[model samples]
Target: MAQKERVGVVVSNKMDKTAVVAVENRSPHPKYGKIVVKTKKYKAHDPENQCQEGDRVRIRETRPLSKTKRWELAEIISTKAI
Candidate 1:
């Protein structure tokens, strides 16, 4: 089976080598049929601590590196503009 991958923006990188990423999911409500945007936060392992807030990054599912970090940073899609 293919591993899960997600692209989202880094919301926080306060931890030593962990980053909080916010991924948005858009889907229509089952009954109302109205589109809804739901945001979820995932803790991804950033071994290099290269991610900064607002940076666009790709994360891949992996073995748990920590209690909350089950995803690892794949690559930085785009860096936050200074």
Candidate 2:
């Protein structure tokens, strides 16, 4: 089976070999029918330590590498200038 993948922005890269990614999406409320913005954070493995805060990245799901990491850095889509 193909592994799950997500495109999100890098939120934190303080931990060695790890980065936090925030994935945001819009969803309609069940009762109110109002659009809601949802954001989720995932801990992704970054072996090269190339990802930085505010960078756009793609992560793929994998076997758990740590207590909070089940995703691995797939590719960096874009880099933050600052």
lDDT of each: 0.96, 0.97
Top lDDT: which candidate number?
Answer: 2
Per-residue lDDT of model 2, residues 1-82, tens digit only = 9899999999999999999999999999999999999999999999999998999999999998998899999999999996
Question: If scored against the real structure, what TM-score would every candidate get?
Answer: 0.95, 0.94
lDDT of 1 by residue, 1-82 (tens): 8999999999999999999999999999999999999999999999899999999999999998878889999999999999
Clashing pairs in 1: none
Off by over 4 Å in 1: none
**Candidate 2: where are CA atoms >4 Å away?**
none
Error of 1 at 71 (Å): 0.2
